[model samples]
Each structure stands twice: as structure tokens, then as C-alpha cells.
Target: MTPRTPDAVTVFGPDFPFAYDDWLTAPEGVGSIPPEHHGAEVAIVGGGLSGLVAAHELLRLGLKPVVYEGARLGGRLRSEHFGGPDGPVAEMGGMRFPISSSTFFHYVRTLGLATAPFPNPLTPASRSTVVDLEGETFYATSLDDLPDLFREVADAWDGALDRILHLGGLQAAIRRRDTGALKAIWDALVPLWDDRSFYDFVATSEEFQALSFRHREVFGQVGFGTGGWDSDFANSMLEILRVVVTNCDSDQHLIRGGADQVPRGLWSRRVDDAAHWPEGTSVESLNGGSPRGSVTGIHRVRDSAGTATDRIAVTDESGETREYPAVLATCQSWLLTTQIACDEELFSQKMWMALDRTRYMQSSKTFVMVDRPFWNDVDPATGRHVMSMTLTDRLTRGTYLFEEGPEDPAVICLTYSWMSDALKMLPHPAERRMELALEALSHIYPGLDIRSHIVGDPITVSWEDDVHFLGAFKGALPGHYRYNHRMYSHFVQQAMPPEERGLFIAGDDVSFTPAWAEGAVQTSLNSVWGIMAHFGGSSPATNPGPGDLFDELGPIRLPD
Candidate 1:
């Protein structure tokens, strides 16, 4: 738990390298359970990506997982249609995903989903970018086009990464799946950074401190990987390092149809060749073609046989109770604290602290469908696109454009704001929010008649207002490392008493790096290991599961 010095950062490896994809692809199928318990039922409390991924994996391993969803299947990966069922859509939650998310991309590629590079600020997908701050505006095709101050800021960030985090080496190690090399670097950093803030890392680093304050301001305004990182300033430095080092915030792409397809596909995907069930067995079929209603209560119960082992009794919104040998709760952590009537004995006091303290960031997205990609039109005089992908200090923090084609409708994310900016628009109606966004943009694009191209109704979301999910995603505040440690490692059920061992938690919030689908996938994989072991099933010898190596490479825990 003590901070260590005199170590080099190598590439970070995947937390679990057991490779579910490889095991599933093999003909032998990951080792199955005894014939008597081949079809044991397990309850999955959410139909989001994490729950769906766990259910799918369990199904492959011969477990019957009944999924219960409160609202929708996709959860945060929701895509809202503007015109029709097959019309242009807006990604309300997780739109862009990085290629480094190997586990998540496994499903994406398996489903044969199409993807295109996300135009992140000044990236290649964007033809041009407009940076507006403090009533000043600048347009650029790439980083080199920006003022020299931006270059200084970028170089300072790169220097900080190399000197403090060793991002390139870590990413390379991750890509190679070199666990030893990754652990050597990450173990050294966990204690030094777990308690530090992202702003502290930037403001105190000699590389950044040597630069002008204006440079730091510009850096916060348009961060290299994700624009306007000021929202993340108060978060744990460990969280920030995890994002940059693992390439989670860079080289991202948008799922072509919708990000929702990943979850929905897993639910409907028939495993005709599954190890346990007969042909045409899918999660949808197992759940009778739809998920059970929202889970309302969860409590521990003893078996009728009076065995020492514990079983979980779950009550849904309809007041119906069902008993299962095990349950996986994947809903937002806050829901467990507020919506669900969970028994105190279900989790330890330390675990409750983690779940109750989990912080979720506020986010608001406003999208408009346009007649075409009018933003792509070149200005007669300036020769730049009429309106570039925008990053601003205005009410409209970030603007993105997605064009299906010149003939088809184009979608524009008018504003994607977080934290304080998100709160500003929370009280306003979607139309009012859009009007305020246009007012702000009109100042940036004075000559362009943006309203003339509007085609369909606008779509908007304030994640904070959703009853199902109180906020957008988990954002680890400074000094929350201990809380995160408890949540992320909840899959190690052996540490819990027998009464609590049968219940598990899995979701993006329970991951080391939250707000990324990669975290969700990896944590779900961990729960699969926990649940498999709970049922006396083990991973194939060829690929030792994460739990098999948890003691050696689990998260580096700092002293309380």
C-alpha cells in the first residue's frame, strides 16, 4: 500500500487474459458442470451490456440465466430515432468506443457490426474543427493549424504522460497481453496516484507548470484524447491515467447501426451449438422472449432442506418472488441504495460504503436531424466547412456531425455537455435547450443559416433526470480509491460469508475504469468467473480465468 519509486512503466495488460472469445471459439467449449446441474437458473438483474454479456457467457457454459430489465435492453447505449424506426438516430449514451476495448470489440466484431472512425475534435474523421473560448474563435484542420500555445499544451501533456505515466509502453504491453510487464508498471503507480486528483497531476507536474497558465487553460478547453477535460479535473488521477494509458479515450469509433446492437444482439443471438441447451437456445427464449419486470427487492434466504448454503430471493415490481441459487446485480449502484429494497445482510458495511458513495457525472445531449451534411459545405471565401465540429466554452460545449450521405438525412449533436454545463440545461425543455444551443452557435457561425437545414424533430437527454439511472456514468472523485477497490473486486466472493457469497455485482461502475464499455465487459467477465465457481464450475484448463489469478494481479490495494 505504500508508494514506491524507481520503476519504469511498461504497457498495461488486460486485467483478465483468460480470453473468453478463444475458449468459446474452441470446439471443446469451456468446461461444463455436472449433468444434474446443467440447467441451474441464475437471476440477472439488468439487461444492459454487462448483464447481457454475463448472461450470454453463462448460457454458453450451460447455465440458464433469466434476465430482468426495468426500462430497456441497451441501457446507457441507447440510440434514439428521429424520423422513423429505420431513420436517422442519435446516440444518447455511449457513442464512441476505442479499438483498445478488446473484450467489448469481440462482441462487436462477432456480431459483424459496422463502425466508422469517430470525429473526435481535431481527429481525421473531422474535416475541420472550431475552437471557441472567451469570445475568441479559431478554426483548424489539424493540431498544427492551431496556435502555437496549443502545441505547447499538447507537448506538455505528452511529456507528462511519458514521464509520469509511460503511456506508450503501457499501451503496447496491454496490446500484447503481457501481464507481468503491465503489473510491474501499474503496481508501482497505484499507491502514488490512487489518492491524487487529475488537476493535481497537471498543475503540479514540472512539465506543465513550466508552461504558461494560458497553455493549461487551452489544454483543459480542448484535451488531446477527449475534448474539454475540465470536467474530469476533480476525478482521481488513477482514473485518468487508466483511461489514457489503456487508450480508452483515443482511436475511437461509432457503432454504425447503434451501440445498442451489442446488447440486443447478445440477448437474441441463438446458440444452436451451445454446450448445454438444445438448438435455437437464446437468452430471449430463456426469458420467454422478454425480460422479467424491474427487480424491487432482494434478500438472502435459506434452502428448504435446511442446508447451510444461502439462496437469493428476488421480488420484482409485480410483487412476485422467485428464488435462485445466485444473482448478479448490474444496475447503477445508486439504484441499489434508493430504488431496490436490499437486505442489510446481502453486502458488507464496507461494500455498502462503496456502493453508496459511487459518484455519477451529469450529462446532457441534444441532437438534431438535418436535411443533409450542410456543415460540409465549403465557404466561398474562407474555403472551410460552413460549420466545423465544434469545441467551445459556450453553452454548447461540444458539437458533432454525422452524415449518412449527401442525399440522406444528417444528424448533428448540437450540444454534449457534462457537469456544470449539463446542469444549466437540466431545467430547460429539449426545445429550449436546442434554442439556447443555436443561440450560442449562431455567434460562432454568424453567416450560416443553420435553422434552414433542420429536417426532423430534435432528440435530447439529461441522464440525471432518468429514474432508472440517476446520472450518466461513474466518475471517481479524489480519495475514492478505497471505495472503488471494494466495488471492483466484489467478484472475489470467497472473502464474503456464505450468506453473501451467492450474490455478485457487475457493471461499468464496479470497474477500475468507469464510464467505458470496456470496464463493463471486463467486470462482467469477472462476475462470470465468480458465478461459475459458485456453481462448482471451473474455466477450461487451457485458459485459467481471472479469479484463478486474482491474488497475484488483482488491483493494487492501498492501506486504508
Candidate 2:
């Protein structure tokens, strides 16, 4: 049985400018567009979550949005099927999503998608968990079930939060939306923590320093929230603090059916009749069921006489060109440099530097389907299930189990590794990866014949090897705070020159929280507002937009 929490934990609210949940519930559409401009088309590049969100919202405001996706709809939210469309799925990209992702959840709930609590490490959803390290094995059902030493390490982590970061206090300020209080606390710490690495913060903490190196090693191996964070030790402490303080790593859930449904649903969903479109208009119908051809180049549009106008022109791979008054690029920022041919003057040199300097982490996952939820079988001798959600210092850093029903085919993420660990499997075939994972699992499960229940083919992914996606997600390293600041602020194109005014950027990487889907949602909304305002439209007076409140609630800027 899962052990109960020894104490109550604080539930923090989202730490961002936008309150998307509220907007979704009572959406006073953005300022109305003049009748003449109601049918104006807006180019939405990248049909991922951000781009879809932008397009969906834009369509509601009586505008026509044409989405240009280079590949599939869901960018990093890929959920691949195994045997057939009805077969068990392997979540190749994002799987677990935090409940605090209220904005992203708004759409999930709106679409009527079912969700189950993600079995994160020793959480209650997990029947059992085994932590293996250096040939030592420990079984636990909750934090209370771990050894007392583990408890001491956990307490030290909390103490570090209270003393150095004032996590609870900051969370309170964010919940209250006390801009002054939040800014005062966060701005002061931005400089203090931005330049420091997460490892440096942990090493210098009095609580951690009092503990032995073994304790630190254990904490790094099986950290709370999102499994082992050792891969992120070299990243900026501010990034780690932001994740923890905002509650981005806890109370997570996975979308039932698949995460891809969110974007696809938006694509085929028809909204009420608006400006140029009839009552049944949808993104699918707008582009005739698929995205426009892959975009090859982007520059300003010219008139019949060849004089460039304020409109932006996008050229597809087949040499078809379309011009729009404004464009939102929601693809990975790295694509601007590697895949697409974008004019250098479209972005300032500093902005270009930030885009190019953006860092992405490597991530790998290998999954397989079983005949049944075999892990649920009881071992009479040990009085434990045959298998449990496993975390190990071995080659397989994390293993997750998912069951649809008692007899239904279950899924197992044999291995989920990051950074150097992920790179180790980059060259291996799926079968070889399964072999390596099974070998590593043997160390934890002992003599168990775990392979007997296997049903169909295995699936594997090494994000770094994918040409379209050079890496998994941004893992901001020290000194990257400035770069993030630059990227996040690019939506404010009103301050730019006329030539650079038509392009708006939105994506998870452009958000303060680089890896979370909420970031993508919020940043996309920012672009939505920017695009509306650009077209001489305004959000209802009752609901001022992000741009309207930028002076009061914008992200905290740090000193150079």
C-alpha cells in the first residue's frame, strides 16, 4: 500500500503574466476588427500546440489563419501508436503534464480529454517503486517508506528552499498576483541566482553541506518531482528554482488517448460562423485536411512594381508564395538557422544571438508492449508485484509502466535517459536498446523472466538524431537568463522598425518555462494579442491583454 504524506504540501499557482484559465471561461474576444479587415489572413507557422492555440483563437476573432506545418501537427507532443491505431501508444515526446498547467489544461478540459495521475517515482498512482543504485536496491511506496537517510536528504532540500529561495513566500506572492511583492523578491534573486549553476547552489547550501557526499549522490540519483535531476546539475539555478517554485514538476497527469489529440482536435474542430468563413469552418477545411507545404524561405512581400510592403511573404518548398499582413513562427527557434532561409534583418543582432545560443538537451526513450499488465502479478515469496516503476543509476535511469486494464495490453517505457546517458543509445537499434534495458532491469528484478509477456515490436527515439528536432528541449545553462529574456520579449514588435514588425515568435522555447506546454500556450496567447493589435483590433475593454498589462506584470528583467 502507498504510504500517506507525513505533512501537507503547498500548492503554488502559475508564475506567469497570463491567466489563461480565466480567459477561457469568460473570453471577451480581442478588440474587434473593422468589417473590411475581418477576413484578413494570418500565417501561422508550425502547427504544434502553440501554433494551433494561436490559430484557434485567431479564427474565433473573425480572422482566417493558415497553418504551415513542416511535418506532423503535434511538434514535441508526439504520441506514437505501436501495433495499430488502436494499439498501445508510446509517448515519444511530452507525457507527464503538471496540473498547475492551468492554461494548457483549459484546452485539454475543453476538448473533453480524459487524464490520469501520472505515476511519478513513488507517487500513489504507482503500485510500487524500486530505487537501484551502485548494486544497492531499495523499495518504497512513498517518501515515508524510504530509509531515514532519504528523509534527511528530503528535509535538507526543503530547508534549502525555505532559507535560500523562500519558495513558499514567493509562491504566496504569485498566488496573490502582488506584482510589487513578487517583483521585489524575484528581481533581487534573479541576479543572485542567474549566474549560479544548480550544482553550485546545492554544494554551497548549508543544509546539503552538513550532509555527506553519499547523501548528495543519493539525492542526485533519485531526486523528487521529475526523477533524477543530475542531468540538469550544470543548468542555471534560476531555471531549477522557477520550476520548483511554480510547481511545474508535481501533481502531473498524462492525457488519455494521446497528447496529440489536443492539436488534432483543434485542427478539425469547427467554431461558430465568423467573418469570411461559414459556420463549419475549421483549420482542416482551411487547408484541405493537411498543412501547407513546408516553408522554405520568408521575406517581406513586394507590390506589383516590386516595392516591398509591410506584409511578410512565405515561400513553400514547391515555390508557391503567400503573403500575410502578419506571421507567427511557432517552430523550434533553431530551425531559423538550420532549416529555413530567414532574412537576417528580420531580427535584431541581439535577438539573433539569443536564438542561435539557445541550448537543447538530448533525451531518449524505448518502449514495448506486453500481453497484459504483467507487472501487477503478485510474487508470493516477496509479497510484491513482479515489477514496479523503477529508477536506477544503471544505464536505464528511469522505467515507467502503464496499464489500460487488468487484461488489456500494457506499455512499459523500458528506459528514459537524458544527456550523456541518452547519447549512449543514440547509435543502437531498437532491439539492441531493448536488450540493454532488459539487462539493466535484470539487476533490479533478479531472476524474473520479464521478457515472456512481450507482444509486438518495440519503439525507440533519440531526439538528437532527428534532423527536424536537433534536441529534446531547452535546458538553460548558466548565463542563459539574458538569452531567455530576449526570446520571451520578442512578441513586443510594436517597438521595432516597420520592416521587422510583421513577424511574431511563439513556442515553448520562447517562453520563460522552456519545457512546459503552459509556456507554449501563454507565449502563443501573447502572439495572438500582438497579431490582433497589429491588425487594428483590440481585446474587449473588460479583459485587457498581456500587452496592455506588460508594464505591471511582465517578466522580471535582470541587470547585465
Candidate 3:
């Protein structure tokens, strides 16, 4: 049997701001009714940011849409904490909010949440050290120094950075769907294809290769070879450039309280109301058919009990089956493919064969709560005193420590990038990730009396082992564009008119974001707009594809 409780998603509630109203709730006064959702104006599945945002917009339009979330409402945006008074808060997932978030800013402002730019504490005096398995080291005076040295070395090398710039310009043109510009970028970057994998590009690229020699073990932590310190490496450059041009505004911030403060509140509304939904009942199946389930609701489905059910058929977690007209699947493509068996071969072909090509990236989140901010003056990890530093070390490419509380400071999380690494490190496939963090810290701070100041044990999670999510976040890895384009394309049958069909799927994974809160919200906006338009209602949606989403949130080029 699969474990019912997930690691981070298990903890979600009023503490966060998720605009969704829960369904599995049994709080005070909220009466229960048998499961019966035969006919509703509209039913949205998956109560993450997308589902909630769409429901909110629908409500505003005077349309009462019923949302059916099988799992925790906030989905991945939920929170998990342990210990007690005087103990540390360990975040099982998610990270700090960057002020440059455009879509995030729109909703945050709606909830009256203030914003601050992401701070850079790595200073000249910071302890920015790059250590290797063999014990060689290079120290930087400040965080800026790392990038500067990288820039100098990179400049002395080949013209890869220049090629990347040209590619960025080309991408800008492509976003406009301008054939001319797209061709230009393609032409400029396509030539470098001779270098084989992005790993090869970095290996041959200048000082980039020196990192492996200098900090072999620490290198993997921050990402080395193709995924490491060489931000200018072909694939890595593409990844960074995409975010740069998109959120070019530059404001990075954290919520006033913590990360979950936003997504959780949104999920609470419905759960608190409880009066609107039936008790102990959830959406069994929705198939598109007539005026009701006409949008192919619940194509081919399975009960919570793991029995393979039909889409046009419905079955409870127990043993029950009913037919419907349409089905809206908000799960990931993999889940949708594995669970919902569709009659239409086209949707199946695009989803199973097309979207499944690319691999999911592995990731780990680590949070350390120290007795005091010993590293605040000079970050022992980065050699520089920057508030945060991206360790080019192979061990963990990303690292950030914060002294939020002066008395007993609780350093926030520093998540490192991974590629299918979570599976090798996690508990099990489809299992909740409670990562093996001791390995990384032991390698870096092997002898530091961590037991002395360490308030409680650190919390870590690896997403690679998660079968449901496959991996934590999906990235446009080497040759990803070719694979990515298919994911957001054909799987969704846009051919069906929204009102008559009533069959659609929406989630963070539907679009290029494949992950991230921004992708989640935009998916809601996009799907809802299409659905509304199909139903003769119109809604304006602002989604920043490749152009630059942060523009909507305002310029982030300032320091908070």
C-alpha cells in the first residue's frame, strides 16, 4: 500500500495564503452530506494555486464552480514544521520569494502582503571558501567577487557568453513568434551543437574546468560539469537567461512570516465554509458528455483504492462506478497518463509519447537552525560574507544562511539543484522525501562542533524518489526545448468548445514552468480564460511566457 501521508503536503492550513476552500474538512459546525456531485455548473480539480485562482476568478464572474481536490489543497505549496518553543522551524519544501515574481506579486498585493528585495549578504569579509574532496581551497572576499572572477575567467575564454547573448536576443524574438528573430537565435546557437552535451561545453570552456580540480567534492553541491559553476555553459546559460529576461525586473523577497503564508490561506476559505460541499464525498469522476459531464469528464479513471476505472465511469474509493460526459485532470502528465485512460488516441499519443521524453530534475532542501549567527559576519561556507552565496562547489551549488532572529537565529533553507539524484537518495519511489542530509553536511563541515550550536536536527527532502511528482521540478535541461514544447501543446484538446465540452486540465506542469508557483497561477489564469471564453464569458489573463513576467510586478532592479 502506498503511504497516505506525504512529507511536506501533510502540513497545510490557515497559516498560509492559498485561496482554495478545502473539501475533506470536518471542523466545527460544518455539517456533512453524502458524496453527490452529479451536476455542478463547473468543477475544478486539484486545489493548488491554479484551481484556487480559477475558482476565485469564476466566483467574481458570478459563476459558482465546485473544486474537487483529492489531496491537500495547497498541493506542493504547503508547509511542514517540527520541534517546539525554542526549537527551529524546518521547511520541508519551497524556498524564499523573489521580489522579481510578477504573477506572485499580483496576488500577494491582493492579500495585502508587503514585499522586499532578496538580500545579498556575501561581503568582502564573508567566509566564501570553495573546498574540494582533496582539501584544496579558494576564498572569495564577497559574493560579488565570485561572479566577478567568473566573469574575468569567462571573458578570457571562448566567445560562449557572446553566443549566449545572441541566443537571448533570438529568444526574445521567438517570444514575439517572429520567425526572423527565432531563426537568428537558432542559427547563432545551433552551431555550438557540435560540442555535444552541455557537460562537454563546460569541460572545454576555460576556468570552468578548473572548478572540478579545485573543489571536486564540494562542486556537486552547487552543481559542476554541465550543471555547475559555469552559468555560461550552454544549457545552464539557457536556463539562467530564461529566468533573467523573464523576471528581469530583479526584486526577490520572502513573505512576511514564512513561505506557506500565501498558498495556505487560499485553501482555507472553502474548508472553513464547509457548508457548500457534501461531507465525506469528493469528485469521483467527470467525463465530457452532455450539458453536465459533456467535456469528456473523467475519461478513464481509477478509484482511490487503486482500481482501474473508466473515464466515462466513476468509482468511489470504496467500490462504486458511474458514467459522465467530460473529465478535467489537473494531475501531472505522468499521473494523467497512468490514471486517466482516455478514449481519444490523440490526447494519449501527445501525453504519453511526447511529454514523457524529457527527464525530471532531482533536488534537495536543507535548513540549519543555529544557536546564533556565527557565520553572519563572515559566511564560513562561502568565504564571503554575502547574505547568501551560490557555492560553485560540486557538493551543493546553492547555499544560503540567514539570522532572522537575533536571540536564537533560525537559518532558512538552502536548496541545491539535482538531476534524478533524489531517487538515489530518497526513501522510496512515490515515497515522501525526508532526505539524507547528513551526507552533505558531513562532507562540508565534518569537524565543526555542529552538535554544540545545532538546536535540532536539520530537515531535508529529495524529490527525485517521488513517483507522483517523478522529480521535484522539471527543467529545460540539455535539449529540453524540443521536449518541452510538446508538454504544453497537444495533450490538452483545445478543439473542444469550453461551455459545451467542459473537459480541460490545468496545473503548474501543464505549461513550461512544469513547476514553481508562478506557473501554477498562470495555468489557472490561462485555463480559466479558455474555459470562460468557450462558455461565452470573457476574462483577461496576463501570463508572462518567455517575454518577461516580472514586468507585471514592477521592476526589481533595486536593492531592498
Candidate 4:
């Protein structure tokens, strides 16, 4: 069948709309610093994808980046190998990435990582899908095989989106990089949706209202693109709109081996085009092959005259202090108040309110490695594969199967759930979680013995339980547009006071599209621009950065 849209959709901001992919791939490169500041040190507090991206780019711009990671290098891009380093991995976080994430794919291409289509429900990659809602099980190779109710729900959603939100027009604007048209559509949506929940949008829309309440329930369980968005029903409708219009959930892919390789590759990859650094220089070699300890405090330094300066002091967990001319904090937003002792004067009260008000949604995943891809075996009675990518309203919610090869051990993500579902598994151990997932799946695939094919230990993760990362990722609540605007626009510091100038932030939490790696990459580029301008550097006129066009193309501001 032919695709709906011929042009590929990109995350070209319904918010900032800056073309980061173009800036990174420009002939002149991002920007350059003065020779005097070639070797100036910049502190990056977090070794996640965002921090690593900033560090990698900063090195190319002829600056030294000192990265401090409390736990591991790849924060949420964690991949847990089952048997050994070369064995199959269970991607605990960020398993699937959409094709619209151009900025992120830039790094993936540069790093030479191989990728394949992820097995989302109803996708060709999964081959077949089994959707078991309430107690009924249906097997299908595509959406056509599903019942009329499923199609009705899908059609209702599309109708509601196009009618209420102008989905197609906004997406066309994003695809063509028409900033004015995109903003005209999205800016109007900011106030309209910022104060409303996603559930409210669906419940109140004329399309779903025409159908029975059961349609809404089915819509939540078997959502569009990915499975079951009921977990995000409480999120702002603007957030949901951004995901839909930008195609953040469609045409997704997974990095072969593991997603963590992206960040780790950036850390160790040599920068051939780096300015002042030598041929073999990398973020790893710059920091002596490893990141520093956790940061405990951050303060703006005062000179002999007792006046605040651009120099910022960073204190590690060992109580060792180092001063830098600029500091880019890419950690979770709550860390500033909870984990780190940041000075009150570093951020304005309004900025502080934005940071403090940021809400994070919980997420949990349980994975088990099996001896082989037994699920591919045929069931003569049912004339279907023993198992298919399963989506159910049961406790498991969504179960994904990953097959490396027929002979190789296969990895099964038993349960990938969020919000209330994730919270339910938080208190349970990995063994108990696996047991609960297997029991739930048994209801869908009765008479199938899943435990017999187990190869090794099961892997489980509750992101909120981790101290270093307070929560999985930010979920913008109702009336959060103002807060999101504050954080997203914080990169442009020319108008800010000197004391709050050098301390910048970058991460998915600080971006409009949180919980996506594209957001992390884009925000990191923004901070790179902010840090560049901090040291008297500028992007080439041909390839002006986000900050250069902030006055005209930045996110629209709402009244106080």
C-alpha cells in the first residue's frame, strides 16, 4: 500500500523550530571559539546523551569539557547484556527511536551504528500482532484484520486531530520546514491545549463523542502508532499534539546491539575535524579515559571585590572543587534542588519555578532472555505463530519480542509500561516482575510455556527508584506551556544578568518534546550555542545557530 505522506516528517519544532540538523551538517560547521579560549575548561554535569553530545561538540569547537557522571556514562540509554558483553542486550531505556529524530540520527550515522525497524504493534517489522483487550484476543497481520471497532477508534482519532488540531496542515508545515506556517498553527494551540489534558481532548472531541465510551477505552488500550497511551492521558494535550504532528511515534527504529552504544561511541569517537585538539583526541582522552564523580554543589564565584563573576565553581562528591568560565548542566531538572547544592542566585525566581514545577512520569520495563526464538514456531491448531507482538490491557500492557537469529538467544521485553502500570511493578523484585508478566501473558497465549525457553537472568528497571535519576522523564502537565517556555528559552542568555549567565541547562527535561532522544540532542546543540556565545564566539553567517534567530523564530511567549 502507498504511504499517506510522501515527504518525511521531522521534529522541526512546533516550539523552537530551529533546524539543528542543518546547522550540524553545514559546510562551515556549528561555530568556532577564539584562539585565547581554545583550551578553556567547561564543566558538563552529566554523562548522558545530552551531556556527551555537548562535550563532543565543545571539543570540536576547541574547548575542553570535563564530564561528571554519578552512575554510568549512558544515563537512560542503558543496555544490559545478559550472558556477556557480546551477548544480546535488554534495552532498559529508549528502545525505539522515530525516523523524525534527524539530529539524533546524525550522530547514529556518524558513529556508524547499524539499525533495523523496531517491532511496534501492527508494523511490518513485527510480522504479526496480537491485541488482547479485556478478555478477547485477536490476531492480525495488519490493521485490516482487526474488528470494526479498532478501525473506528483509529478513524475517530484521526478525524478529531485533523478537525480540532489541524494535524495534516501542521505536519505539512513541519515537513517543508515552513517556520511561519508551523508557528501559526502551533502557537495558537499553545494556549488552547496548555491548560487541558490529553484525555480531555479525546473525551470532548466531536469525533469520539459520536462513538460509545467503549471506543475511548479501546483507544487508550490500543493507541495510535505505539500501544496504549492511557499512561499519558493526564499529560498536556499540547505534548500529545507535538508527538502526533512531528510523527515522533511513527516509523521507529532500534540500534543493533544496543542503544547505549550511541552515547558510548560519542565519548570515545575521535573528532577528525576538531580545531585545536590532536588527531586522536576524544571526550574520553580529554578526561583521561573516564568521567569524574558526581557533582554535589554548584556556585557562582565572587572576585576579590566581592562581586559575582562568570566563573562558576563545581563541587564533586569527594568535596573537590573546580572553577570554570562556563558550566552546562545536562542532568535531570530536579537534581539542581535535590542532588546538587546549586546557589539560589544562579537562576531567576521564575526560572527556578519552572525547574521546580517540572513533573516526571514513572516508567518500568522487565526483560528476559530465552534460549532461542521459540515464538516463531507455528501452532497448527491456530495456524499462527506461537506468539506475536502482544498488546493487552492486562498488567503486562505491552510485550515486545526481539530475535537476533534463529540460533541465537532471543530477548523478550515482557512488560514495558508507564505511570500507574509502572508504579505497580516498582515495589516488586525482578523475579516477581517476570513472574507477573508471564502470568499476564498466559491469559493471552494460553497453553504456551514461556519459562521453559529462559536462557539466563531477567533484567528489570524502575527509573524513578534510581537516586541519580529522580524520574524517567518530564511529562508536561496542564498550564505547563509557560514553564516549558522558560526552560526551552533559557539557552538565550544575552538578556540575563551576569551572575546567572554562565550556568546553562540542556536535556530532554528542558526541551518541549521530553522522553525522546531528539529532544536531548536538540537541547544539547542549543547549549553548545549558548556556551559558544558565552565565550565570544559566533556561528557563521551562512549557518546561524538557534540563538542567532531567537528574536524572530523563538517560541512564542504567553502572558503572565
lDDT of 2 at 439: 96
Question: All candidates' lDDT scores?
Answer: 0.85, 0.84, 0.43, 0.93
lDDT of 4 by residue, 96-175 (tens): 99988988999998898999999999999998999999799999999999999999999999999999999999988988
lDDT of 1 by residue, 1-560 (tens): 11111231211233333444444455555556666668899999999999999999889878999998999999999998877768887999999988766668778877788889998888889889999989999999888998888888989999998888877767666666677877778778777887789889999998999988887787787887769899889999888888888677888889887899999999999987666799889999999999999999998876578654577889999999999999999999999979999988788899999899999999999999999998888998988889999999999989999987877898999999999999999999989988999999999999988899988667899999999999999999888988988888889888678767888999999987788997888889889888988888887776667787788777777788
Local distance difference test, candidate 2: 0.84
Ranking by TM-score: 4, 2, 1, 3
Error of 2 at 278 (Å): 2.7
Can you write out model 2's per-residue Cα lDDT over 425-449, one digit (the tens) per residue?
A: 9999999999999999998998787
> Which lDDT tens digits does candidate 3 get at residues 336-433?
44544444532544345545664555666666566776545554664553233435343444555554555765564543545534334454321122
Q: Estimate each model's TM-score.
A: 0.95, 0.95, 0.64, 0.98
Alpha-carbon deviation at 317 in model 4, angstroms: 0.8
lDDT of candidate 4 at residue 341, scale 0 to 100: 97
* Top candidate by lDDT: 4
Q: Candidate 4: deviation at residue 57, Å?
A: 0.4
Clashing pairs in 4: none
